[model samples]
Target chain A: MIKIAQLSCGTEYSSVQSEIEKAAFSVGGKMVYPDVGADDIDAAVKEFGFNPRSPQLKLMIARAVQLAKGVYDADAVFIATCFRCAEAALVRNELRRYIQEHTKLPVVTYSFTERMKSAQLLTRMEALVTIVSRKELLARERQTGLTAGLDSGSSTTKALVMKDNKIIGKAWMPSYDVVESATTVLNQALEQAGYKLKDLEAIGTTGYGRFTLGRHFDAKLVQEELTVNSKGAVWLADRQKGEATILDIGGMDNKAITVRDGVPDNFTMGGVCAGASGRFLEMTANRLKIDVTELGKLAEKGDWRNAKMNSYCSIFGIQDLVTSLGEGKAFEDVAAAACHSVAEQVYEQQLQEIDIRRPIIQVGGTSLISGLVKEVGSVLGEMPIVPPDSQYIGAVGGALLSSGFLM
Target chain B: MKKIFIDPPNSMILFDIVERLGHEPLSTMAALQERVDNLEIDMPPMNVTLDDVISGLKYAGIEVPSGIRGRLATWGPHIDEADAAIVMAEAPYSFGCVGCERSNEMVKYLLRRRGIPVLWVEYPGDKEAAMRMLEKTKEFLGGLE
Candidate 1:
C-alpha cells in the first residue's frame, strides 16, 4: 500500500484525525507520521531559518523538512491546518512549497474545520493516492486507444469519443434523466464517431452522477473531477508540462483547481450558495425575456455599475434583477450585472480557497458565455484561456483518464 | 419515549411542535436551564466549568473559541442521547450570534457520527419551506419510537 505523509496541526485536538485517516485508508492509502526525532526537528528548524510559536507547528515543519530531505519514507504529502490564526496558515503554505520544491511527490493542502467529516476528505485522499500510485498514467502525453467518456453533470450530460489523441465525436444535452442522458449522449457520440459502443476499448465516467452512470455502463474507471478535469484541461490546452489553474462554474457550485505539469496537487470545490454558478445566469436570462445564448452578447454591450447587483445569494440576486428591471433599467445593463455578480462571487468566495496562477483555464458550459468570461476576466485582471470545446471538459477528462486502462 | 434532538435550541416553535408530537425534545435551552436551576455548585450567568470547556475537545478542536466549546459541552451529551435529530441549517435562528451557528455545526457533526436517523432541512424563508419543515419534522419524530 502507498504511504501518504500526514502533516497537520490541531487535527488531533479537533478530533478529525480519524476522519482523515479513514479517508486515506478507504482509498487504499496508509497514513503515517514522518518519524523525526526532537533533535532532528530543532536542527531542521534552525536550518530552515524559521521558528513557529506552536509546538504543533514546529513539529509539522520538522516532518516536512525530513520528508524534503529524503530521510523520511512516504509517497505523497497531505498538509492541513485548522481554519484559525495567521501563523499556522503561513506554516502550512511554506512547508507545502518547501516540500514540493525539494521533492517530486504530489502534495495537497486543506484548511479543515471542527465539523469536517470523512466524506469531505475522501476525494482529496483518493486524488493523492491516484497521483502517487498511477504517476505514469497521469504523465502520459497523449491518448492512444479508442475510449469513451461521460460526464453526468447536475445540469447536463456530456459524452465524447477519443481516438489517437483526437476528440473525434462529442454530444451534450440537458440532464432531465440521469440514465437516459448518459445513454443518449454516449449513443450520439458513438454515431458521430462512426463507431459502435463495443468498438470503444475503455470507458470512464466523472461528475455528480459519475457513480450512478459508472454502475450502469460497467465503466472501467469512476473518478472525481479534481484529478480528471485537471488532466483533460492541460491536455486540451497543451499546457500538459507547465503550471496552470482551472476554473469551472457548474449548476450548483464552482471549482478552482491549481495544477503543476498536468497533475492536480491542490483544488477547492463548492461554495456557500448557487449565486456563483451557471444556474444563476440562466435565471438572469429568464428574467430578461431572452434566450440564455443571447444574454451573453447583450451583456457585452452594457455596464454593470448601472444595475448594482450586490447580492451573493441566488434568491436575493433574482430579487435584485426584478427590482432593477421593475424600475426601467435596460436589459443589456441588467444582463451585464447578472454576469458580473456571478463572476465577482466566484472571485470573492471560491477563489479565496486556492492560490491563483496564470494561464487560468475556464471550462464547463458557462465558459461559452462571452459576457461571463469577460466579467470573470475583469474580476481577475487577466484574460482566461477557454480552450476549444471547453464545454465538454468533464467528458473529455473522463475519456482521457480511461485511456489509462487501455494502456 | 424517544428523545428527539432539535437544532437551533432557542426555536420555541420547534420545541412546542416536538412536545405536541409526544416525544422528549432535547434542546440547548432545556439543557442549560437544567444546569442553571441547580444551585449546588453553580451561579446564574456562569453554570459550566473549565473542565466542561476542555471536554469539548472530544468533539471540536482547541482552535474553536471557548464560548462555542462551552455551548457544545451543554449540548454534546444530549446529542449522544438522541434517538433522532432534525437540523435547520442556514436558517435565521437568532438576532445574536449566540455562537450557535458554529456550535450547531459541531453538534450536527456529532449527530451524524453517532449514526442516528437525521433529518436535515434549511430554515424556511417562506411559508412553503416552513410548511415543508413542519411536515418533515412531524414524520421524522413520529417514526422515532
Candidate 2:
C-alpha cells in the first residue's frame, strides 16, 4: 500500500494527522510517525542542543520520520504543504527535521507559492482534457473535420485552428465573458478554417482565463504554462537544447520559466503585482495618447541613457516617469527607459539569482514589441530567442496540446 | 503634558487605549518596520524597549544608560520624554498574535514590574464606541486631577 500524507505543524497538525490516519486505516495502511508529540520535540532539541523556541522546530519533520520504528508493510510519502509565510516556511523545516530524526520516508517539499501554481495548472488540465475528449468522441460520429485552440488572455483573445500538425486557419478578437470569449473566438477560428465547432476532433484552452474557458466549453485545458510554452517554443525553434529561459509577458501578468536541459525545473511569476507587466506599459502609452504599437516601435529607436526608475511599486514607477518628463527628458526616452526598468526589475527579482546558461525564448503579447525583445536580450546576453507566429503562445500551446502534437 | 508611547507589534487593545489617553502617541519600532514599503516619514521610528517605558515615565525622557529591558533590547535616550507608555495588543480578546504577543507581553510586564502606570487598552470595534470611550477616559483623568 502506498500512502501519501501532507501534514501541518503547530496546533493544526493534530487534526490534519488524524484525518490522514483515518484514511490510511480504511485503506489497510500503517501510519508513519504515529506517536509524534511534544516529547519528540523536546528529545530532538535536547540531542541537537538547540532551543525549542527557535525556528529550528520546523526542521523536526524530517527528524521525527527518522525516529519512527522499522519499515512497515506500507510505503509512505510525506509532503510539507504548509501555508505561505516566512514563519510557515520555518515551521515546515521543523516538521521535516522531526521526520529526519525519526523515520526515513521520501520527503518532498515546495514553497507554498510554487505548489499553488502547480495545483492551479492541475485543476485547469483536469477540466480541459475532459471537455476535449468528450468533444472528440462526438466529432468522430459527426464526420466533421475541425479542431481548435482558444486562448482567452487578460487583454486579448485568439483562436488557432489546426488539422494534422498544420495551422489551417486562425482568428483574432478582443475577448469578453467567462464562457463566450473562449467559445466565440473558437467558433470564429473554426469558421475561418471552413468548419463548424462539432467538426473539430479536439479543442484545448490555455491562458490566464483558461479556467473560465473550461467552465464554458467542453474542451481540454492544459495549465503547464511552462510545458505549453516550451512545447510551442521547441516546435518553433526545432528542438535545440542548452540552458533556456522563456519570458512570457502578457498584458496583465507575466511569467519567467527557466528551462534547463529541455525541461522546466523552476519558474517565477509576477501575478500579484501588475506594475511589472506589459499592461503597465500599454496604460502608460495610452496616457501619453500614443498607440502602443507606435510606442513599441519608438522604443526600438531611442536611448534612455539617463532614465532612473528606482521604485519597486508600479504606481511609484509611473510617478517616476512623470518626474522624468518634468526633468526635461524626452518622452520616448522615458518610455523606452520605462520598459527597460521593468525588464530590470523582472531580472532582479526572477532571473538574476537563477543561472540561465541556455538560449532564452521570449514569448506572449509583449514579445511583439521588437524593442522589448531587444532590451530583454541586452540584459539576458546573446541567447537564441524563438519568435512564434502571432506572439499568442498560450493559445497556440493550448491548440498544440489539444492536438497532442506538443504534449 | 502626559505622554503615552505605544510599542509596535503590540497588544491590539492598547492601540486604542493610548489613542484615548489624550496624549501624544508614538508607535514602537516594529510597527513602523512592518509598513516599511509604504512608510511615509512624518516622523522617524522611535526606538524603545520594555525598560524605557518605565524609565520614560520617571525621567520625562529616556536616558541611554538606563538600557532596555527584556530580550533583543537596545539602549536609547529619547524614550523618556513620554509620561505614559502603551503596548498595542494585536489580538482583540487575547493579548497578542503569535510571533508578536511575546514582545507585547514583555513591555506590559516590565512596565508593571517597575510599578509604572501602564494600562491595557481594549480595541473598540466601532468608531462611535471608541470616541465614547475616549471621552469617558478624559473625564476620568480629569476626576483624578
Candidate 3:
C-alpha cells in the first residue's frame, strides 16, 4: 500500500493531519512527517521565482521534477496537493517531481480547474483507479491515520472516510435539518475511521446546503460548487479513464460538471426546479410501485419502446406517466422511458451548449437504479455511462478528499 | 494636466465642477477622433453616424438633421477609455443591481489595473449624502491634481 506522510500548516492542519494518520495507519500503511506550513511553500517557490500566473507547460515541468525529488527523499508514496486558487500553477510543477521520485508507485496530484475540459481528464484517471483498486479490506485493521470527507449536498448530507486513497467508512442521510444531519453522518464516519471529531483538522462543506449549515462547523467552506463536485467525482472515480461528465441530480435542482485534464472546466445547472430532477423519479417510482433502486436494473433487462414523454414540466410528466400506464405500458419500459426522457431533455437544454464527446457520469440517489445508466446510454448513443457505488459518490468523494487534504 | 471627457447632455453640478477645473472642452469632434488621428496626421472624414434616426428635418436627399447628430456625437468611446470614472450608485437598490453594479465593478477593475484612482458616488439620490459625496469626489480629484 502507498503510505502518505501527511502534514498541514497551523493548529488546524496538525489536528487534521493527526486524524488522517490515525485513520491511514489503521488500514495498513506508514505515515511519518510533520504537517506542512506556508514556510515550506515559500522556500520552494522562492527557488524559481514562481509567479502565480505561470503557464501550464512550465508548471507541469516543475511538478514532475518536484514529485521525483519528494519520492526519493520520503521513501513512500508522495502526493502533492494544492487548492484551486492562486497556488495551482505552483502545485502542478511540484506534483511532477513527487511522481518522478515514486516511479515504482503512482504519485497522485490534484489541481482545481474551473474548466470542464480539465475535469474530464481527472475523472477518467480516478475512475480507472477505482476499478482496479476494488474491495478495500483494510478497514478491519487501523495502522496509519486516514482522512475522511463530508459532502453536504442539497438533497442529502453524506460523509465518507478514507485511508491510503481508499474508502473506509461512508454514511448518507437526506438533508432535512442540514446541521443535525451533517453532524450525525460525520459522527458515524468518524466512528468508522476509528477517530473522533476533535481529531479533524479540516472539514469542507459543499452544495447548496453548505452556506445554510455554515454555522455548524469550524471547517473550510469551498465557495465554488464546481470545485467541490470535481474533487468528489475524481475521488469516487478512483483512477478511471475517459472524460467525466458528472450529472448531479438533486431534489430542487440539477448540476452538470465536466472534468477535463484533472480539473473542472465548465458546468451548467437547471435553475431550481425539481421537475427535471431526481425528485421526479421518486414521484414516478411511488406511483409505479417499483422501488427506485430496482428501477434502473429492471429497466436494463426489459425491452424499451419509444414512449413520448413531452412537457418538460414535472407535473405534466407525472400526468403523462399516469396516462401512459393507463394505456397499458410495462413498468420496466416506462421506467426506462422516463430515464431516457430526463437525459434527453437535459442534453437538449444544456448539453447542446456543451461538447458531449466524453462519457457521462450519473450520480446522486437517482443514479443508484440499475437500468437507468444503460437506458440513458442507449438513448444517447455511443456515450459511455459510469455509475459508481450507488448514490454515495459525493460522500465517497468527500472521504477521499478528506484523506488527501488531511494527509 | 490631461483633459477628461464627460458624457450625455449634463447636470448643473457636473457642469459646474468641470468649469471650476479650468479645462477646455476639445469640441466633441476632436475628442472622438483624437486616438486614431494622433497615430497619423491623416484626419478621417467627419461623418454623422446617428443622423438617420431624426426623421422629417431633412434637406434634399439627407433625411435627418446634422445638428441632432452633433448633439448625440458628444459621447464617444466606451467608458473603458477613461483614466478614471465616477458613477452615481445607490445602496440596496443599486448595490448589486444588474447594469450599475456590473459596470461599477468592470470600471473599477479596469482602472485599478491601469493604476488610476476612481471616485464612486454612492447613494447619489439621497439628499443627506450629497455633501459627503461631494467631499469624497473633491478629495479624489485632489489626489489626481
| C-alpha TM-scores of all predictions | 0.70, 0.55, 0.47
> How much is A199 displaced in model 3, in angstroms?
3.2
Q: Model 3 chain B — which ten-residue stretch has the worst lDDT?
A: B93-102
For residues B1-145, what per-residue lDDT tens digits would candidate 1 score against the true structure?
A: 7888887666677678888989888976787678668787332344554566678777767877554565677778888888887777764324112333455566777888999998888878889988988898888887876
Candidate 1 recovers what fraction of true contacts? 0.01
- Chain A TM-score for candidate 1 is 0.89
| Least well predicted 10-residue stretch by lDDT in candidate 2 chain A | A136-145
Per-residue lDDT tens digits for candidate 2, residues A1-407, read: 34434443321211123333444444344344433444454554455454433222423442444345442222343333333334445455555444444553433333322113233333222222222233332122111224567777778787888776566777666667747766677777777778877777767776667666755666764443545565555545544355567777767766665554344434545555667788778866876678777777777776757766656677888888888878988777877786787677677655642446566777777777776777787777664375666465655666666665223
Winning model by TM-score: 1
Stretches > 4 Å off in candidate 3 = A1-145, A212-214, A221-223, A239-243, A301-306, A402-407, B1-145
| Model 3 interface root-mean-square deviation | 27.9
Better of 1 and 3 by lDDT: 1
The candidates score, on chain A by TM-score, as follows 0.89, 0.68, 0.60
lDDT (10s digit) by residue, model 1, range A1-407: 88999888766434466778888999899998998776676688787777875556778888999898889989999988866546677788788778877888778887776567778877778888888887777787688799998998888899999998999999999998888999999999999999999899988898878889999998988887778878888888888988899998988767888888888766767645788899999999887888888888999998999997989888999999999999999988999999999999999876765678888999888988899999999999998999998888888888888888874
Each model's lDDT comes to: 0.81, 0.52, 0.49
